[model samples]
Target: MAMFVHLTAAANTPRIRRAGIRADSRGQGGVRGVYCFPVLPSYTLTHQWLRELARFGPKGALSAVHVRLDDAQEVLVGHYRDRAKDAQQWLTAAEAVARVAAQPDPRGWEVVVPRAIGTREVHRIRAVPQVAGWRYLPGAHGTRPCTCFGCRIRGEYGGRRLRERHPHPLDGPPPPVPVLLARIEAAGDPGDPAALRDALHWFGLRRRGPVDRLARLAAHPDPTVRRELVWAVQGWSTPGVAELLDALAEDPHPDVREAVADVRTL
Candidate 1:
């Protein structure tokens, strides 16, 4: 037999003890299963998913259900992202344990049994420390975050604060033109490519702005900055924009000229 541990809300202990662990959908393609980690010699490895699972349960209180399955019982085992039917490999319960145990770091690996665990298969349920494992991803602590809109969930804990602090490039409202211009001006001599790109992005968003102050960026040494200028000036009703586009249309860089052609078509 192969030993595995299933983590769940502490509140579910009574029902689980009565009916055993019911199989649930793994959140994609109606494929139902019970997710577990093979009970390895290392306690931390056996319960590595506890902290991440706690986010979906009642606060951080969770119980570990120890289960015993026949070594030949077929199960799916792979990284969490490979849960799709075609991506995961079917391995026996014992093989799954060996695969995960051999890994130097298996934080995101999982085992999914296709059917409910019988009451006889469940050995015991015990409370575990709320802080037993990594969250977000293994070794994610101390890493800089990617605050793009697609990476953030609206109502998730601290999501609102994070979005406000680091607004998405394309989702949030653009800052006023004067603020962007000030940022460019504060960038000094050759100027910050990031600040210039930020200002240009706002032009793409607003599509219409005073171009007199921005006309100088067309001559910026960076072809990317000039290409962004081509994108920024498209569809603007402001004066001198036509002349600016005409100049960008003949830019030395083929990419900048291509951007100008693209803008003209739009």
Candidate 2:
């Protein structure tokens, strides 16, 4: 959403607005006159400007969302490699970018701060903005009545409500296993299939971005992930995916054999 600006010095013009002064370069008033690398504008400025422009332009219009980080104070990542809170900071920053920076304008974001891990595996859980499209909800400033997951669950269980959210927050947590599995069957790529698959075997719910994880599992060097992915695909496999799994029947791993057999039974 940005157009290149080319300005040449006419007579009294001494500075160019295209580039900014850097550490190596010197600036007199607002005019920067020095050669740091080779080009008039360094790559950093171009990248930074592009990011800035994207924030202000229509490209980020669809990314507007309200992310509420619930219990994001104790996320542990690379505990053995990195320190303890490294993953927590990374998760917090990522949520900020996805909710604020990635969007066209400033808006609220739902931040789910997970305190404990039920399993040992690394599940890079994130909260994606599920706000309605701009066409559907014009000038939405994240103050609309939400239907968050906590409300829905409490309603289903016929219990008292705990969180300040709607019964169906557009970006609530995720649905339960059976419900999520049903949703996956209905929509393969609609609500994040890969997330559903990963949660199916472990977390009991769908995740943020599971498609890439599912794809990686499908193409994993290990046999277990590939084999499990076959069943994962069974719930929502297209013809192309079936063909891909069919080719895997020739794998040397016996688990692949078992997985292919399960597919035929399905």
Candidate 3:
């Protein structure tokens, strides 16, 4: 999911042999992707788009820049040290290439198929973000997956839950308890750390009455259930919780105890 690619120690004085979004014509069933040739010596090209373009699959346009190596020599030497091959490498860099080179038709969008238009900045374009926060968002240094599948699922849960179920906002109440919980639980395993965290976080906000009955297992005897109970209870802002926290705050296990203490604070 991370595409901060081809920046080699040699890249300090990187000798950009060749870089661009391209379609390769070599294979029987060529794939398209963004490619960089003769990458910083010893540094392998792993960005999937490059390989995809090299095979001429659905690839973007070629837009890359070049540089001459100077102080970067030492950096390249060090980067490839781990690899068995220790040698010099380089590739070609071309400029002002085609973009299929044209403007697009707006009204014909759904009916007409499309080809990519190359941009001078094409090389810098990001992959289509598959999941929220899975991108190297602007202003961030290193890229990390900011959202897990569970988190995305939870957001979807929240969206559907908050939507108007009937013709008017007050036409009917929100979804029933069993229906709503089952929908959330269907998003993924409750045992998943992210899923559990989302479940506990959301239910606290809805605050459905007959609360314990609606969230039955939320107060079950099992330690896992107890942990979730503590997660939700700590967020309860109203009255009568001091007694509950008191019994839980000094519980046997550390995690449960911590959860109890957290609930007390809430």
Q: For this target, which candidate reaches the highest TM-score against the unseen true structure?
A: 1
Q: lDDT for each of the candidates? A: 0.83, 0.35, 0.34
List candidate 3 segments past 4 Å from native: 1-175, 178-202, 211-221, 237-240
Q: In candidate 1, which residue pairs clash?
A: none
lDDT of 1: 0.83
lDDT per residue (tens digit) for residues 185-227 in model 1: 9977578887788778777756579889888888889899999
Which lDDT tens digits does candidate 3 get at residues 31-83?
23322222222222222223322222233332223222222221121111123
Error of 3 at 105 (Å): 25
The runs of at least 3 residues in candidate 2 whose Cα sits more than 4 Å from the true structure, single-residue gaps closed, are 1-213, 237-239
Q: What TM-scores do the predictions have? A: 0.61, 0.24, 0.26
| TM-score-superior candidate, 2 or 3 | 3
| lDDT ranking from best candidate downward | 1, 2, 3
Error of 2 at 126 (Å): 57
Candidate 2: clashing residue pairs, number: 25
Better of 1 and 3 by lDDT: 1
